[model samples]
Target: MSLAPILNPAQSGRAGVPCSVVGASCLLAAASLLAPAIAADTVRDRDKAAIRAAAQAYQEALSRGDGPALAAFWTADGDIVDEQGNTLAGRKSAADATKPAAGTVRPDMRIRETNLRFLTDDVAIEDGTVEVGLPGIAQPVRGRFSATWVRGADGWKLAALREDRLDAPSDAETLQDLDWMVGEWTVVEDREGRPEAAAGDKPAMEITVRWNANRTFLLRDMKIPAAAADEANQAGTLNVTQRIGWDPLSRKIRSWVFSSDGGHGEAAWSRDGDAWVARTAAVLPDGTQTSSLNIYSFDGKDRCIWRSLPTHVGGEHAPAFTMVMTRKPKGKTP
Candidate 1:
């Protein structure tokens, strides 16, 4: 039996093998043909392992000021990012950023690695903190850093690096007109009374407002805190949407605020004897209907505060909630 001849390109026209005798050789040849595929998988695994190992070593070299060692691990087009979100690209750029930081060392400084995610066999993302000491500075510079790596023909290179200052996550707030409610504020005092206590007596929520160029199309966002939130309703959030505009037909101001949750109501605002008064009405979550008369005025210091008195069933007055919001410093809070 000459099954081998079937696979040999140069041995065309060779006599065919006996079927019974060729079975063993046929199996062996099939296995031989599959050897390259299996070997290829092994090679891929080895390459990935090597890349990971190189990345780890490179990181260690940066920490220890092994410039030459670190440089050897990166591809020619590698990039680096500082903790302040500054980026330096290419081998030269990376070298410059690393070289200066590498020269300084302080025993009290702390550097920690946090998260590493592999997007693919050839791409990865790493995030961590870099704390370096300064000569006279009381505290070390601490910020987060991230790197995007790609496996190139020569080796693994950084495709991009983004560094951003690390800060505590801020409560959301409206950024622009129609920006919608997005910041944290609490109801410190309610003079008119509480219809029912907002999830918290403090009644903290976000306020957002949007306006168009004509100023006629104005939208407002109010978030209601969750009932169970004792600490200013950090967990549960409810939204209130309102639209305000001038009606040419009526020649007056018209607006409505609807609790996106269950409270739906309209508020009409106009000048009172000495200030602005707004009348509001909406249904509560428990199927109770109520109406509100709110008076707003600016104090001697020009701080705005609102008094809200709500009436329900047969015009019976009850205290629901009062809201006083201090103007945030121009650029202090996030």
Candidate 2:
């Protein structure tokens, strides 16, 4: 008789299923994985609801002129940075700043979300604009606002907030630095190979240099004298003054070249090893492009020499170019 084989308790379960003690542990682990997935979904839903509710409450508080209510949405140590990058930190300052607008003017402020960026499960950034009607202001003064929010057990609270005035610089102003170029100097240029000039006219033009208030920036105010036939147009020779200084931001020397003929140009100077190099970009009267480059080397005896590249505009290398100056002697000022 073909009788059914007695089922073995451990091995009789299913095909490919392990029957050893390790198998039970594996089965148990597989079942436990569902708990975390369920928990994650629940937490995500709650966080979403909390963020929405908190954002709505904050908006309402601002429109209602509720100082305490508005403050409630922010953390105790929250900070505010204005458009000019000036920061007002802590609840006290933030509260005080808000009070000005929350006063009797009765603002119709709205906080609609223009952008929402989540940094983590607990941190987020909200960007929008605030429009208010101040007394005597014809149009509404609208400024962009950004606030950082943090998650809490109750909901999301603002941790830091900042706003900016789009049309102007910040209240904090940065002073210019140019303290390395205070001295007297003279420029000597030699112009040759030009058919328009008489013999021995190939070289030599003179210029004056000065610096203001012990500044690093040296101003090159140069004058070009005209010859006998050109004396009638002597007033039209070259009158250019460049305010040169070092820019800490760009880590390069910069200059603003202003001409007496109502023209202007910008220049940048940087050092490559022992050589100082400069490139100038200028606009001509007819809106044409003019450029030049110079490489400078200083001798041990306080003399600076510059070699002009092959492209000058109207005076020297090509047209109006090249500069060299000797450090002035002591006790005599230029």
Global local distance difference test of model 1: 0.50
The positional error of residue 259 in candidate 2, measured at the CA in angstroms, is 1.0
Q: Write the per-residue lDDT of candidate 2 for residues 1-334, one digit (tens) a residue.
A: 4322323444636444435544677778987998898888798678767776777776565444355666667787887654434344435432322332211333345554567767887998878766644322234445677778898876688888767543332222222322223355554542242223322333244445566666566777765555411365455566778888766675456778876656687766644434454555566454544444555655545555555542210111122323455566767744
Name the best candidate (by lDDT): 2
User: Which regions of candidate 1 deviate over 4 angstroms?
Assistant: 1-187, 190-203, 227-235, 285-287, 300-302, 316-320, 332-334
Report how far residue 18 has shifted in candidate 1, in Å.
99
Q: How many residue pairs clash in each candidate?
A: 18, 21
Error of 1 at 36 (Å): 99
Each model's C-alpha lDDT?
A: 0.50, 0.53
Model 2 misplacement above 4 A: 1-182, 190-203, 214-216, 227-237, 310-324, 328-334
